[model samples]
Target: MERTLVMGILNITPDSFADGGKFFSFENAIERAKEMISEGVDIIDVGGESTRPGAARVTEQEEIERVVPVVTELVSIGANVSIDTMRSKTAEAAIGAGAKYVNDVSGGLADEKMAKLISRNPNVQYVCMHWRGHSNQMQLKAEYEDVVKDVKKELDERVAQLLKSKVSSDQIILELA
Candidate 1:
C-alpha cells in the first residue's frame, strides 16, 4: 500500500483558518518551511491568500508579493514548493520563481485563465480544489442538491478542460475537498 505523504502548511495570510498571518514575515516563513522540511514533509504548500471560511480575497499583486519571494527562497534551498492560488498572474509568477506546483482552491472557478496557464506548462504539477465562490461568499453558495456529485462533476469538467488544452494527466493533482 502506498503511504500518504504529509503536507506542511506555510500560510502567509492573516486570516487562514488556524495559523493565519502568524507566519507572514519572510524570515519567519522561511524558517517554518525549513522546519517542515526537517519534519519529513513531502510537500510544503505556501499560501498567501487566506481561504478560511470567512476570509476576504487579497489583490493579485499582493498575493504575488506574499508568495513569490518565499517560493524563490524555498527553491534555492531545494524545497518542493506548491503555491496555493487561483490567480493566473500569481501562479505564473510563482512558477517562474521555482514553485513546483499550483494549488488552486477554486478548481478554476476563480479564474478561467488558470486553465490556460495549466495548459501552457505541462510539467508543473497542479492541485485543483473543490470550491464554489470566494471564501467570503462561499458559505452562502454551498447549497447543493447532491454536494458530492456536484463537486465531482465540477472537478471532472475542469479536468476535461485542462486535457482539452493539452495538459497531460501526469502533471495534475485533483484535490478532493
Candidate 2:
C-alpha cells in the first residue's frame, strides 16, 4: 500500500481564521513546526497571510518578511517546507530561502506570474486550487452549475495551462476547494 504524507499548516499571520495570533511570532511558529514534526508531519506549509473572508491583501514585501524567515528556520532544521502564497515574488523569495513547494490558493488566477514561476522552477512543487478570486470577493463567485464537474473542468483547464508553460506534471498538485 502507498503511504500518505501528512502535511502540517503553520500560519505565521495575526489574522488567520483558525489559529490567528497563536503562531504570529516567528519563535512560536517555529516551535509549532517542531511539535508537528515530532507528531509525524511529513511537510510543513507556512502561510504568511490570512485568506479569511474579507481579509485585506498583504503586500509582497510583507509576505516575504513574514514567510522567508520561517521557511529558512524550518529548512535549517531539515524540514520539508511549503510556502502558502499567491504572489510570485513571495514564492520566489521563499524558494530562495529554502521552501520546496508553493501552496497557491488562487490557482494562478490572482497573479499571472505564478504559472511562469512554477514553469521556471522545475523542482518546486506547485499546488493549484480551484479559486475564483481573492477571499474578499470570492464569496460572490461561489455559484456553480454542477460543483464537482465545474471544479474538475476548471482544474483541467488550469493544469493544461501549466503544462503549456513547461511545468512538469509531477510538479503540479490540484485542490478542489
Candidate 3:
C-alpha cells in the first residue's frame, strides 16, 4: 500500500474558511509551504477560490492572480504544487505557472474545459472531487440514493472521460469529498 499521504491546504484567496490569506503573501506562502515540507506534506494543494460553505465565486482573472505566482514560487522551491480550481483557464494558467497537478472540486461539472486541460497535459495528475454546483448553492441539492456507490460511479465516469480525452489513467486520482 502507498499509505496515507498528508496534503497541505494553501488557500491563496482572502475568503477561505480557516486560513485564507493568512499565508497569501508570496513570501509567507513560500514560508508556509516550507513548513509543510518540514512536517511531511506529500502535496501542497494551492487554491485561489474559496469553496467553503457560503463562499462567493471568484473570477478567472482573480483566481489566476491568487494562484500563479504562488505556484511558480513553490515550484522554484521544489514543492509539489496542486492547483485547486474548476475552470479550465485557471487550470491551464496554473499548470503553466509550474503546478503539476489539478485538484478540481467540481469534478468537471462547473467548467467544461477541465477535461481538455487534462487531455493536453499527459504528465499532469488530476484530483477530481464530487460536486453538484458552486458552493453558493451546492448543499441544497445534496441527495444521493447510494452515497458511496454513487460517488464511485461518478468518479468512474470522470476517469473514463479523462481516458477518452487521452489522459493516462494512472495520472488520475479520485477524491471522495
Best prediction by TM-score: 2
Assess each prediction's global lDDT (C-alpha) against the native. 0.87, 0.92, 0.86
TM-score of 1: 0.94
lDDT, candidate 3, 94-137, per-residue tens: 89988889999988888877888888898899888877778888
lDDT of 2 by residue, 1-177 (tens): 989888899998889897866999999999999999999999999999899889998888998999999999999999999999999999999999888999999888888899899888999999999998888898999999999999999999999998988889999999888
In candidate 1 the C-alpha lDDT for residue 166 amounts to: 76
TM-score order of candidates, top first: 2, 1, 3
Candidate with the greatest lDDT versus the true structure: 2
TM-score of each: 0.94, 0.97, 0.93
How does model 1 fare in lDDT? 0.87
lDDT per residue for candidate 1 within 75-106, as digits (tens), equals: 99999889999899999999899888899998
What is the TM-score (0 to 1) of candidate 3? 0.93
Q: For model 3, which pairs clash?
A: none
Candidate 2 vs 3: which has more lDDT: 2
After superposition, candidate 1 runs with Cα above 4 Å error: none
